[model samples]
Target: MFAWFKRKFAKSEAAPAQQERHFMRNRTGARMFAAARQDRLGTAWGGTPLTADEIVDRNQVVLVARSREQSANNDYGRSFLRMCRQNIVGPKGVMLQAQSMTARGKLDNAANQAIEDSWLEWGKRQNCDVTGRRSWRAIQNNCITSAAKDGEFMVRLVFGADGGPWGFALQVLDPQRCPIDLNDQRPRTGAFIRQGIEFNRYGRPLAYYFTTTDESEAGYHWGGKSYVRIPAEEIIHGFLEDMVGQKRGLPWMATALFRMRQLGAMEEAAIIKARTGANQMGFIEWDDGFGPETKEKDDEELTIESEPGEWRVLPSGARVKESNPQYPTGEYAPFYKQALRGMAAGFGVLYNNLASDLEGVNFSSIRQGTLDEREHWKDLQEWLIESLIEPVFEAWLPRALLAGLIKVKGKPLPAERLDQYRVVEWQARRWQWIDPRADVNSAVEAKNNMLTSPGKLIREQGQDPQTVWQESARDVAAMIEAYKSEGIDEATAKELVLLSMGRPQPKVAPTGGNTNEAA
Candidate 1:
């Protein structure tokens, strides 16, 4: 009896543990809830299992995602590009500023200017950047925008004789041409290459696969089995990864895809119904007189163009019912907003910014929402600097040095000393304060208290402090010249400017009569 009881109790006692283990299999249940119960819905995740590779289906994902982005009805895709414009690549893009690392010895001003000017001039040249578009701003925008939409961005350094025979030019490559095949991952070596990107054992990318669009238009190229291998140092790929060792990027729109499709369908339906102007539309049923083949006169003549408030003669025993199928009612806006909120979260944008709706928003809420948006934008800005801007700079600086476009201390700098000459910073999009006076007052206080400096404040405004000082000096000189032209002496005009500028000046007698006259 004891043995039988023990055997029976053993099974029952282990059931809860088995259930717990099953629940833990769910992606969220294990960590979120202690006694979570996950039901099997006969899906691949519940009863069946799928690996990450099996689930992602890389080839299909890229094709379908890019196709959907081109679709006219793809509001989410359009909004993503729009978000990229508003946040990532704004009006004035990420700016490069050179700074000296050493305190005593400042960088050669002329060399810094030459480097900046040469890059700007080169950026405007056709074919200088891979796209053959004549603007660095445009190139930066395209790369970042494409990355957000298409998952990855690729650019190759095109140097040597063919590419202008001077400094390097960049060629933006379409990722479709660079296939991410399984066979590429295998090697007798210590590296793994996937989708044209090669990675070392430590998971750092060592190379990339780059080629022009496949010349063969053969059979639609279903399985991308080929790509040209290129070193990683020659290519700049920009993408955000969720996992630590994610080999590739999942579409930024992936999370919102389902909801976006549903929302689009709903909006289209609403628009169609609204255009129909359907008002209490219903049919009069003939219970007794209607035959299978016969058509009623009233029903035949009754089209959507029928005049309203007209009394109609009906057949015998005709029953009328009104089926006012109301769409886009008071509930519609809130429901739509609720759906968009999720999309905005996925896109890392605020609801108002994503939807451009301010129906019920007040100052405090809008301010807070904008603040949250700024933080997200700032994060992206930092990412852009680290990934795209810095690498490009590192590549460009050496090329510029070799091309003799940049001269450090009036001489050609070696590759080894590039770091010393390459000391620089990039500035991202800046915002004007909500209350300018208040914000300025606070900044002034901060500056006076030594909490911050003028340079910091100027940079926050997206203006270079050195440039501001130089321009101010020029303006003061011009002002002094104008005063001198009006009969004031040179010293008096300079003194006036110095006094107005709040600089210490020697004591001077007051003007006798005219404002310009000095005693």
Candidate 2:
């Protein structure tokens, strides 16, 4: 009886074990999730639980190298880069407007003007860059172009003696200068340096390690190169982050690179085929093996040149077979277009714009495409402003103030008011209308219906509303005064001013008619 009771208890304990194994077997066999199954289809999906940083570390070098090659050699690659810079930065670049206000909440016009003037001065070609070659606009261009090409750009802030008179300057470094494989542990703080960036336990960047020698120099990779440790505050690294906690940027063209290479190969092969077809007219065969006379003629390298509409008489029993290559056939256009469309989608651009193909596109379609792409450009413009422009301005401001480079009323700006002075706006260049007249009419109608304001309209044109109003007021006043000097009545001068400004002329009372009737 005791043995039987012990056996019964052991069987009960084994019951749960059997149930668990059965559950696991069912889960594996059915695969609660199709993607979780281990089959031939799933085998190709090498999905891993690697973090963003690890993925970037594994691919950044090759990605950047291929991206640069595409930009240098591929026509579409060059177009993408050009479009990014032209649309994001524009010829005039981003405009800065000082919005510093006094304690009374009124515009501090003098201080604002002073700051603007000083900033423009510092933006000159000889002042903005450490190399003294790039102006502020040129620096902006380089930053945008580099980001497009390398997926990131680094600017080192120079202060004090190295910063020239303003005590601030920007140094644009090649992203490669910061080695991607430089990883180590900090001896003092026990922090981690991954991809040349030193980070604390919380993953905040502390400093960046830049190689002393660039890749062009001998021994750049394993030549015992020294690294300069620059604090995180002094380095502005601009990149678009697509994943959470991504430490590095991937090239914009990374996904499209393989497609671009294949497209080039296809086009080259097609061209070669066309050229071969054009060059080789036909082939000739002898009736028998080369006779003594034919061999002698071949040995002498005798050849026949045919002109237009010319015919040649062939030897007896000799026939010609024409070569026709049907490569790059009717299917080629559609396939090439589809490939380009995919590439454009990968690059976040319109296929028509990238390929410059306007076929079958009406105004509505083109307008919609332009509008959609412009929104993407605007997003990037804002990113550029936040990532690169704002930081540089804030860093330069305090230094400029301390160095007495920016003055108000002939006195240097007080450093204590830096926070107040930092209140400013960055305006990116706006796109012009495809049809200016139609756009203007729409804006007027919207305004008439109280749907939009003059300020909003002015802003849409990439100008400050207040600035436009002020300029308009000054111009009208000057015009009115000049008319008065010419003996024109003030009422008539005002009417003329309104007329020139494109305003409807005031209604005049009909002769000998009631004013109420005119109204």
Candidate 3:
């Protein structure tokens, strides 16, 4: 009785395991594997629950093998044995043998057909998604298979406007992960049944796989069938933002200097003068016939003045012939010529002064210690020439000459005809005397040299050169006074002290050879 009870319990225990294994042989095992592969690939699945069509196709096949002893005991066992030998290879003594050859061939054909159809449908879906969204365009012809052990899948992708390619691929062996129901009516029921006849639980199935590249090498590969989580729109937005953030061109200091030079040239030129003089006068003669006095009185006055040996002329006897002493014939001098010359000279001085002042201001502003100081000074110099120097020369020089303030040699030309002289000697001489470069150089050098000397120290210490010279003069005066008081004659005392001080007046060298040689 105890043996029977134990045997019955053992049979019941074996029933569930046997049933689960049979369920795997149908469709559950294959669907589970596909679901696992999908999980590995990371593709998104729609909200719809898992269906049998997504997990296992009706054409899919699974083969099982039976033992030889079981095959010998029943007809069903023999058929099952034959089917296993033709497809699934059974474990045997010293060798393994396929049980169902025809079933294996049919399963192989169905697998190949399923893979091809899936790949075609995937391509169509990808094109529709990329093109419809308008973020991607025309696909390139290059398609490649993955090197992974999972079901091999191929991919074709499109190139961007800048010629970079992007797309997705499926891995046929690994497959994608999917959700499934436990009941028979469910789309893919075999996968859940493989876990046993537990009605309350569901199973995840492995279906189509999506992948870009090997996980370890994904980021290293670009312009391939690798799919990035970021959308193309976000990338383009970032690029445009960066472009808008940049700046262009030179700074305000340089621009302002350039514009000032351009506009000030003409105005500056209208003020420079070459030479100035003040003594030109015009002489005018008047006709006595048109004088206020009558002609008879003018003739009488002429007759009296014509008498010889008489310095004084007698008054005319008749009042009509009387000469009025205060009355005189003359012409008034015009002051316009002198005034014009003075104005021209004033303009020349003004132009020169303005140029000098601007140069000095620029020099003072530039720091000598700075590396760019030389360049800054050069720019300022160019500005001075264009805005101040050249303009003054072109416009003011001519106006000065026209106004008669500028003269040729020492002679002043009339304002109306000042341009007659091709070369104005006096103006040229003045310009040579006031040479801007030589004057500025001499002044700069003198100032620099003066700053380092004992004379400079004395001045800074509050002593004056004029005061020292004056004190020396006073000492000589005192020595003269002492000599005169002591009756030591002034000339002798002066000579004695002058000799003591070694103050002999310098004698001019007679010629070149008379000067002492350094030897």
Residue 264: error of model 1 in Å? 0.3
Worst 10 residues of 1 by lDDT: 213-222
Superposition TM-score, candidate 2 onto the true structure: 0.88
**Clashes per prediction?**
5, 0, 39
Query: Candidate 2 residues 125-211, lDDT tens each?
Result: 788887799999999999998988899999988887877767789888888878888888766886998888999988899999887
lDDT of 1 by residue, 1-519 (tens): 999999999999999999987777765655475334455542344435554444445443654455355434676668767777667767767877777444458655665566666666666746366445546777778777667766667777777754563457777666555655533554577787655567887778887764444435432344654556777778777878765555665566667777888888888989888766575477666576552336545534334345688876665566666666667788888888899999889888888877878888998898888878888888888988887777877877887776676555677645566777788777787788867788899999999999999999999887777778889989998999999999999999988998999887667866658556643
**What's each prediction's TM-score?**
0.79, 0.88, 0.14
Q: Which ten residues in a row have the lowest lDDT in candidate 2?
A: 213-222
Candidate 3 lDDT, 300-411, residue by residue in tens: 3223224566576333332223322321112111232233223223222221121222333344233321223223323422432332223222332334345344333444
Go through the candidates in order and give each one's C-alpha lDDT: 0.71, 0.87, 0.31
Query: lDDT at 377 for candidate 2?
Result: 93
Candidate 3 achieves a global lDDT of 0.31
**Candidate 3 residue runs with Cα over 4 Å from true position:** 1-251, 254-368, 407-519
Q: What's the candidate order when arranged by decreasing lDDT?
A: 2, 1, 3
